[model samples]
Target: MKKNEVPQDGDNLVKGESNWLNYAVDQNGEYVQEISVGWEPENIALEQAWEVVNEKVEEARTKVLGGQLSPIAFYMEVNIMDIPLLANYMDKYQWQVRRHLQPDIFKQLSEETLDKYAYVFKISRTELMNVPTNKNTK
Candidate 1:
């Protein structure tokens, strides 16, 4: 589908500007430099994919608010990462990652460790500390 047909919805995966190669001839019928353009396609599959993501986010929010899991664990769930995956990303052992899921242990993490987790989650340490409240659950 053409770029004009791309959907603009809450579930849209491609919301902002994107690049696409254009191969159209110039007015003089000569090939010009390829220009960047915005392009995206509306697909039901992508919409459904976001639905699953939202469900997981909700679940994580619930767990965090209920005190069943720590804020870090909630972020892990929202980011769709398991303990093993996060451990591999952080270059720590799986047991270390699991221990960090405990509220007591997470609270004692050093600034460097917090920075590592924040970097992986693409959030700041402050944001990581502020777990989503129940009211903000979406």
Candidate 2:
């Protein structure tokens, strides 16, 4: 696309407060960089993606609160991590992490085990032991 043809449909993402560096062909048929407010298609796609993320967070919250899964599961969703990633961070096997996500197993964990999980999740041991009542915050 030409430099002048760079999309400026609207700046929904940043509300006109930020600009993105974009490259396009100048009138001389040379590549040039320009600032763009935003592109509508990209903005819409991001909005949809965030909606899906929020849905996952909400589902995790529900499962944790209902005792169907441990707070580890909810924290995993919040951190955008999977069992393998959490296991890698905790220096444990995937089966161990998966087992930890079971509320029964989680409740029986030692302080040392819980502390490791808290450290990886960047939360206090208390916070790791309990799920927040609200999804966004306590």
Please give the clash total of every predicted structure, in order: 0, 0
lDDT of 1 by residue, 42-132 (tens): 4456567877877777777777767766678878876888899999999999999989888778889999999999999889899888786
Shift in Å, residue 99, candidate 1:
1.7
Candidate 2: pairs in clash: none
- TM-score result, candidate 2: 0.85
Q: Which ten residues in a row have the lowest lDDT in candidate 2?
A: 9-18
Q: Which 10 successive residues of model 1 have the least lDDT summed?
A: 1-10
lDDT of 1 at 121: 88
lDDT of each: 0.73, 0.88
Q: Top lDDT: which candidate number? A: 2
Off by over 4 Å in 1: 1-42, 134-138
Clash pairs, model 1 backbone: none
Would you give me the overall lDDT of model 1? 0.73
Candidate 2 regions with alpha-carbon error over 4 angstroms: 9-18
